[model samples]
Target: MAVRHLGEFVVIVCLTLVTSGSSYAEQLPNVVFILADDYGFNDVGYHGRLHGSAILTPNLDRLAGEGVKLENYYVQPICSPTRSQLMSGRYQIHTGLQHGVIRPPQPNCLPLDEVTLPQKLKENGYATNMVGKWHIGFYLDACLPTERGFDSYFGYLIGAEDYYTHMRSYNVGSKTLSGYDLHANKTTVYQYKGQYSTHLFTNKTIDVIERHDKTKPLFIYLAYQAVHFPLEVPDSYMDPYMNITDKNRRTYAGMVSCMDEGVGNVTRALKEAGLYDNTIIIFSTDNGGPIQSGANNWPLRGSKGSLWEGGIHGVGFVHSPLLPTSVKGTVNHELIHVSDWLPTIVAGIAGGALNGTKPLDGYNVWSSISGTASSPRKEILHNIDSLYIAPEILPSYFDGEDFLWRFLARVLEDKFDTSIRAALRVGDWKIKTGPDASASDVWQPPAESGLHTIYPIEKPNQKVWLFNITADPLERTDLSGKYPDVVDEFLQRLEEYYKGSVPVRYPDPDLEADPALHGGSWGPWE
Candidate 1:
């Protein structure tokens, strides 16, 4: 066994496999990582079993039923953080992306020195291609996908954009500026102006699959911009969801269905290209859904921007014909984070080397996914966001009859500063510290269900919370009062993580990033 130190995590590599001849390398599996933006926990069809939900996802449900469903999967609370972690196989704190999504005007992106998953796969002879959203960064050519080890790239540089026009608008100081964001290998292409992005991305992926050579393994990162904000979809797609009374939800469901159909089409393309047997398709959401925008994380608390279970507990699954017969169609409850994908695919499946990369925070969880062994990971550092601002407490909270006594009791019992928005999970225990009032913190059932649950509002001063997440997945009960020792231990762990974290990389919006200065398209401006 070759022991490779990856920052704080020690990765044990098998020398025999690493030194093997071409015969061993030829057996590597083709990987297709499909990432959905702002997808909710209870939005998929498989979860419809719980409440007879109306949201439809036939292709996604079929994919999960044929593969292993990751019931305990986790992702960051927002887009850029999860993408950075997935690409670098490191936590957001290590990458200095611990704050928020990469703004369109910020001159910030994934560090240039970081070895991305695609770059590593390419070194092992895989053909790396990317389609759809690339939100990590775009202030320089070095930050573009093609420059970062991808053989070819087709996508938008920033996050949200108009689905049809492919236009994105950003506030540059006092003026709002808009530009076309669609790109093909660093070139802005205007031919796709009227094409729907979901279908457009799907077609491009199929083209890649159809043109791929069978001799070499393939890697595709299809990061769909579906089901995010703006809530736009073709009328035909929304026709089936007329029963959904909420207009935003109806559009949202249509967007999900469109993405699902694209998945099915891509799967068909893989089969037609004779790559189905050796391909591994992994589907995951970038973060939890924002309930205010027609998304629901029913029975789970919080939305996209918070550290609550609903915000970080993501939807994920691995679909491949190569999975063990016994593990097929089963749910794996082992803990798995988004960062684990790099090692799980690059090292575990592709027989690649991680020798030159920086220390990785991810673990190779292939055995756990394959039902051969338990997950090597037991703890997940969800985040330590120093820049997070808790919502202002309402005056009603202070005006309550027993507010004085309750406030005193909380002040005395609090073990850590709640003003710092941070969360950590160890074993079954999860601790949250900081003031979080995201309004979307309550459970949001499907709009069509006409159901709502009232949750207690957090007091302005109350910050620390402890919960045995496994026992109370809904987060309805805070055990900070019942377990002082657990709270102390978790707080200590958070402090340790904070001490090692890099300073946040959030930069002020650069005026140079204005698309008006760059041919009416968002691209490298610095």
Candidate 2:
């Protein structure tokens, strides 16, 4: 049970935060969290993919040199779950959304009960604004970004929308909300007349910052939609890609460059607003880039949707005025997870409830990485939640096609609790298992003869893999055969986490009555 401290008071005061061990600073620097969509680790100039390893982003490169580069950052294998962890500070399993698209009336989406980062920060006097793709939970007035604590919400409620069309498949109470609503909270904000997703999101960010309550600080959650899918890039901007060898990749490069410029614009906005000094800015992507769609996350295998290191290991740069010049440009290789953002930002602001802060599954990565202190994370956790079918379990997941997407979608559509999978990574080691209980979709023998891999037993269901990710990041080695003890130990931890866990649900909030109030509810969606 959470002990609610009716700290419902919203106070905005202008003062400096000093660390002389002398006085307490009243005003906190504005925080801007820029989460880009489908940006691979090697896509930026800082990480070295910009301009096809040719042209460079002087601004972004300079930003990394000014901030701390997180060398071992890990997000979810996909987007919505990553957003859930970033906002709720909970593991993906804790939230209802285990896999696939998060639509309205999605009983599996983040239960209306989880408290989001903005909800916590808003209580501390910052005006919160969210603009760009929000895949955390359902889509509706109740499940929208504002309901999750953002003062202003602008962005698509779905995964990927057409760059020009701004159209997407949707469902409300099992019915879709298409066409008009896309413009309501998404595509139309900031007078986004005809700009592509990358450009419009950037401009909206500036507008939010410019129109912010200056007397009070601001917390801007800018999750941009670019380089994700539908190959949406303005012809004028993408025509340059024709000169490149690969058409798809060339276009991807153009989209990424546009996102880089968008980021550049935000920083300039900070400077213009005179908030750059004390501001704390973070830039990261929701997941790995698309391998089929011209993504270059080499040296690491797998793309968006898989459990491979490439799928989860994205890049991060933290630039806060609080750090010393020496700490700047210092790369911290600590294993940091996305769940850490909420608690860390809350701690930094000296706001909300940290007393019984649920021993968050994530650490305040900045504290140690920024030289405030030093410590190393023992293990990290990630989940694809890709398979939550019911009634019966399938023996294998299709490595290539998305027939599985439709299949898994139906498992929930038909209401069945058929799968459970969890993982624990001790250093570079990992373990995962499928739910063995349930009367749902049992795997039938393949008419073809070559389905089984190792022992060649035609079993109903089994999916397990262990790897020394640091040594074999692509996960091709399959160290499970060689390191049984390492696998056993991590597997024990994973099981313990599963058996000892309680389900978490997103809470509905009376935001109109009190914009910062948070509540949640949870039940068996199947």
TM-score of model 1 (CA atoms): 0.91
Best of the candidates, lDDT: 1
User: Which digits, one per residue and each the tens of the lDDT, describe model 2 over residues 47-164?
Assistant: 6543134324566677877888887788887788888889887776666555554543344456577777888887888899888887765434466676778878777766676776
What TM-score would every model get versus the actual structure? 0.91, 0.76
Model 1 score (lDDT): 0.86
Q: CA lDDT of 354 in candidate 2?
A: 55
Q: Which portions of model 1 miss their true places by more than 4 Å?
A: 1-25, 389-416, 457-460
lDDT of each: 0.86, 0.63
Q: Name the top TM-score candidate.
A: 1
Cα lDDT tens digits, model 1, 1-526, are 1222232121113222332343333456789999999999988999855864688899999999999999999999999999999999999898899998999999999999999999999999999999999999999999999999899999998989999999989887698878899999988999998999999999999999999977788999999989899898889999999998889899999999999999999999998888887788999999999988988888689899889998999999999877778889999999999999888877877767777878888888887887767888888999998887455443544677888886787567654445678999999999998766559678777888878756765654777888999999888889999999888899878877887899999999988887889998899987
